[model samples]
Target: MLLDTYGRIATDLRVSLTDRCNLRCTYCMPEEGLQWLGKPDLLTDDEIVRMVRIAVTLLGVKDVRFTGGEPLLRPGVVGIVERCAALEPRPRMSLTTNGIGLARTAAALRDAGLNRVNVSLDTLRPDVFQTLTRRKRHDDVIRGLEAARDAGLTPVKVNTVLMRGINDDEAPELLQWALDHGYELRFIEQMPLDAQHGWQRDDMVTADEILTSLGGRFTLTPEPDAARGHAPAERWLVDGGPARVGVIASVTRPFCRACDRTRLTADGQIRNCLFAREESDLRGPLRDGAGDEEMAELWKKAMWGKKAGSGLDDPVAFQQPERPMSAIGG
Candidate 1:
């Protein structure tokens, strides 16, 4: 098992397949998106599969999550899922998507051994969705959700990033919708990932406020979280349905203490922390003929340097390396 200096086991790995996405979500991307990662810098599918194998076989990684500016944007993403699923003791494989392309790829993804998917949909209102994403794809996203369900992606999860004046009022409505459709709904507190994106603490809607707004309409039971990684969300089940809800209080109640996730960007850099300024580049070494053993050593060096946790709430927080959240695979 690869344990970092802070004693956090490397059990979960989030790999970004690409830095390109189809939507321009206000929270994630700027109106004018940042420059994209050059093709030469991005890791090939073979390289990604090799790295994932090493992570699961040598590093004791138990779960593998595929993310991206939009993972579905990556050609042959289903092939990557197939390779990850073939591991000796198959690691739990999942994907996080914007759900724009799920309508066409959900079945293929499930057949390729993807265990689950988490879709990002911040609002149910078409105008609100357009306002938040700068695109009118609310109906498309909804269709993607239904398609995923029809494809046997049960308990499909919808992730909503709640901003104070933007979509906070729709919290109860979203929760009710999730319950009605047997989907898992999660409300995430906004974070300060992009300074240019106007992330303000004052604009965040705390998890407590979200729970209070529900107002005993449904009994909230804390679900058992025996998983090893730090997801930050305190999960609960809404009574009278198979649906569930989660609250990710990143801004108000940080879960850095138990953070066990390591992100591998599409360009092959390992990020020990989301807010970290330092990243160890593996793409250059891999492309230049580095063997798996050599790459494994580099991985250790990066993991060993991880801080106990990121103090993002600190008034004196340092500037994150200029990589936008899209490039970092959120």
Candidate 2:
């Protein structure tokens, strides 16, 4: 198991398929986008599948989430998912995408053994969406969400980041839209992951403010702490019934102590934490003909040195990761 000295075993693996994205979300990257990985730097389908197989069959990863600069942009994503599905003791599979091309691929991805999806959709208004993502493909995201639901991606999750003045006012409306559309909604506090390194704590929409804004329109009952487990999102029963909502307060209420996730960059570097300043290279050894056991031991050693927390509370000590959310595969 990928157990750290802090005793947090990482069973959830987030693999970045590429450092490429179609949309330029203001919080992720600049409008012109950042320098992308060279083709040779990215892991091929076989390499990705092999790593995932080792994580599941060898390191005991129970869940595998394919992330990216935008995973839908990966050419062999479907085939990759299909191959990973064939592994012994198959792990649960999902994707975190920007929802641009998902409209056309949802059904195919479902058939490829992808269990579900977590799409990024900040607002229901096209104008606001365009402003936030700096893309006019708002309708495409809507279509993608509808397609995922139609394709039987149960409990389709919508990840919304509430920026202070940008789309913070849409919190209630976003939740209402998700509820009406039968999608699970999660509000994530904006962290210091932007490429511009322009994140300001005062400008962020905290979890408390989110609940307060939504309280004006709907009632939210807190879900039990035990029910949260290692998940980052602290959930709530929306209106005291079947429908529910979640808030991932990474800035204010960090969940580092229970983090079970380990990230693999598009170039195959192991990131024990999202805000980690260091990485362990797996691609180099793999291309050098390292065996599976050797690579797995390297991964184990990386996790064993993970820090206890992200250190966000100490502004002076908490330096923004050199790599932005795009390169880091949020």
Look at candidate 2 and tell me the lDDT of residue 245. Answer: 95
Which residue pairs collide, candidate 2? none
- 19-136, model 1: which lDDT tens digit per residue? 8888888878777847888987889899999999989888888899899989999998999999888987899988899999999999999998988889999998999889889998
Question: Would you list the C-alpha lDDT of every candidate in the order shown?
Answer: 0.84, 0.92
Candidate 1: global Cα-lDDT? 0.84
lDDT: worst 10-residue window of model 1:
312-321
Q: What is the Å distance of residue 286 in model 1 from its true position?
A: 1.0
Error of 1 at 267 (Å): 0.4
Estimated TM-score per prediction?
0.94, 0.99
- Per-residue lDDT tens digits of candidate 2, residues 1-330? 999999999999999999899998898889984788999999989999999998999999999999999999999999999999999999999999988898999999999999999999988889988998888999999999999999997779999998777788999999989889999999999889988998998898999999999999998999899989999999999988689999999999998888999999999999999999999999999999999999999999999999999999787888889999888887
Where does model 1 exceed 4 Å of error?
195-197, 224-229, 240-242
Stretches > 4 Å off in candidate 2: none
Error of 2 at 279 (Å): 0.4
